[model samples]
Target: MANHRAAWTDERAEQVIGELLRVGVILSVVVILIGAVFYFLHHPAARANYRTFHSEPDDLRSIARIAAGAVKLRPREFIQFGLLLLLFTPVARVAFSVFAFAAERDRTYVIVTLIVLGILISSIVGHI
Candidate 1:
């Protein structure tokens, strides 16, 4: 009975993780679409200038600033933030896995997941 319960718990954790990823993707897409709607509505006359590209301002480059801009209803910034969310989904999954492993008392996986998470965080932060 104890062994069956353990297996069931592990299965449940995997299911939850899968669901989390699916929901994250869907939410990110919805946010991106909302941003797109705002962007087009606000700038009906503006056309894309992909041939002559210019980088976004420094303020919009950072996550903190992007979030602030989104809160202020800046469509472009909100789009960027949505992209940021898409990028962060995997990281969130890893973080969640670390906690799940810890809960399961799987020391090796917990340590390994933590290492992956640290590396992931450093890579993102290093650019900033």
Candidate 2:
């Protein structure tokens, strides 16, 4: 009887692990698709620029020089940068929720994620 119980428990554990793996794969694919859409919509040029900027030490120096040339309008650019940073808050929240749900199957995480997104949207509308 004890042996039979142990075998049943092991089988249940395996089944749970398998289900988690399947969920994880599906969640990963969804996250990737969302990221692709966001990237294409908001900052299609950002990846190319980032690659060039980090390509070498000479590239870094060149980027620095270009930034230095923009010193006169730095204040305006800084404000724009802050707004751009704020725009990412909702995307980050969604990504975090996806991972949390996939790893732990927690419903509270979904609620928290929605709250974060609401706050981000409110802040953006209020501030800008």
Highest lDDT against the true fold, candidate:
1
In candidate 2, what residue range of length 10 has the lowest lDDT sum? Answer: 57-66
Model 1 spans > 4 angstroms off = 1-8, 126-128
TM-score of each candidate structure, all chains considered together: 0.86, 0.32
Pairs clashing within candidate 1: none
List of clashing residue pairs for candidate 2: none
Q: How well does candidate 2 match the true structure in TM-score terms?
A: 0.32
Displacement of the residue 12 alpha carbon in candidate 2, Å? 1.2
**Candidate 2: segments with Cα more than 4 A from true spot:** 1-8, 47-128
lDDT of each: 0.86, 0.48
- Writing each residue's lDDT as its tens digit, candidate 2 over 4-113 gives 43343434544655665556555555544554565466555654455444443332223343234224334323333333334454355465554555345456866776
